[model samples]
Target: MNALNPVFYKEKIFSAAWFRTYGLLVIGSFVLAMGYTFFMTPYKIVPGGIYGIATILHYKLGFPIGMAALCFNLPLSLWGVKVLGKQFGLKTFICFILVAFFADGVPFLLEKCGHPHPYDPFQLQDEVLLASIFGGVVIGIGVGLILKTRSSSGGTDVFTSILSKLTRKPIGMLQMIVDSSIVLCGLLVFQDWKIPFYSWLTIFLMGKVIDIVMQGYSSDKTFFIVTDKIEEIRQYILVELHRGGSIMPVRGMFNRTEKEMIMTVVSRREMVTLQRAIYKIDPQAFTTILNAQEILGLGFKRLEE
Candidate 1:
């Protein structure tokens, strides 16, 4: 029984992790679908990716946006596997499928319930700009959640990767080129200048929101201090601040004098306290401070998380 305890706990941990990942995927897919069904599609905003093309088809040919995106995704995914020799994996396939189901199903249910405009149930037609902004934020949050699980909603990224391989262009550049072409297609189809502008705005906001979600709002700062009074500062950091840090030997380029440099990370408030203490300890100390976007280690966020 004692020997089996570790194995039992490991299984429990694995099960919990699996459940958490898939739960996030489901919630992310639903949120992404809501952003499209309510905020984006109704406004005729093409924010780029497979969904952007699907939006155009929905308006032009009366195709269902979610179904259209899936149709494009399937072939693209297969082609990607052939050319890139990379598997998108089951999680990615499931994510896009869930997005499709929720995207189409919700609107259909709304229509059956006798909503005046099933797509724009909130009547956001007159508020296109607001719709674009909120749509980006919501979509960003959804994508961020999906990404945290190391899965993706398989789409144009696969196509872009292929293009990158063929052209030997950077993947990031190819992605921009492909997305831009799709945005231009929307302009030509809709013949509305505002559509592209609003779509670009949505794209920009989504990118910003995604970064924020991934890194979180940082309140930690990193400090690199070069001082002759190394012992004084080291004691203050270890004893007073109760923080761990690294100390290294350094040589001044101007004076050719040997010195010690201390590197440490602390919270915003603690940074201020340390700054004052360092000033009092050594007025001539050279210090550089930088914002720490994410810190995962002892006395910070857990490595597992």
Candidate 2:
């Protein structure tokens, strides 16, 4: 939708809800980057992209990490704007600047506390595997929130998007390949393959978490129950589950006996309850539950009404 579109101009975009979402993304990105600088970088666990290079520089040359990340990402982000499109580029630029600024500020705040802990307890510990999992979760939350706002924390993701467009390969596979190369570099320089391996783990988990957040994690199922107790089945489905269904008359394919066919859609949790209700009402109910790729109606979220 255009910026001027009614939907785009909805009050929600400027409402308290929008501010909350933006605040979460900013804080989450800052905390995750702090985790890297204080714990992951001190121990030399490079994950990849601008953040990976920032960790390396922080460990080797004592460069300011937020500055390093911002500098490194600037050129790539500019390239993204030139190549990707205006909207994507602008959003990413804003997100990157915010992350860089906050990441740089976090360490100074921690030092002021005189905790001597040196690391963010809100983040993963010094352990490589835990760092990968927790760092990925934190960053994924940041990225996912930005995405919900039509923004991105510019990094290798932009490069991957460009590469996927040119190569006609799946974005996931292309990202894996590009990120794996960075991990290889870390391994080659440090001579510790475990670091690179854990970095890859972080990349994998981030992909999964971002996908779940962007698309939602709800799984749905469609059931087709063939039974003689059509009335009981309908009552259980409509009343107990509060779901709508359709019943039709049919003849058995083999026995040529008349039968009633019931079709319904439900979430995963509701599917179990429905099945149990069917079994209770009619033990011999022949039911077939199929994975529904798409459903559109009152109970489900649909692209079109």
How far is each candidate from the true structure, as Cα RMSD in Å? 5.1, 4.6
Instruction: Report every candidate's CA lDDT.
Output: 0.89, 0.74
Candidate 2 segments exceeding 4 Å error: 1-21, 119-126, 218-222, 226-229, 246-270, 280-305
> Per-residue lDDT of 1-305 in model 1, one digit per residue for the tens?
35554333222345888889889999999999899889999989999999999999999999998999999988888887789874566678899999999999999998999988888887865899999999999999988888877678888888998888898999988888888889999999999999999999999998898898777878999999999899999999999999989999899999899988999999999999999999999999999999999999888888877
Candidate 2 lDDT over residue span 174-250, tens digit each: 87777777777778777886887788777777778777767766578889999989998898888878889888888
Q: How accurate locally is residue 175 in candidate 1, as Cα lDDT from 0 to 100?
A: 86
For all predicted structures, in order, the TM-scores are 0.90, 0.77
Q: Give the TM-score of candidate 2.
A: 0.77
**Deviation in Å, model 1, residue 4 alpha carbon:** 29
- Looking at model 2, the pairs that clash are none
Name the best candidate (by TM-score).
Answer: 1
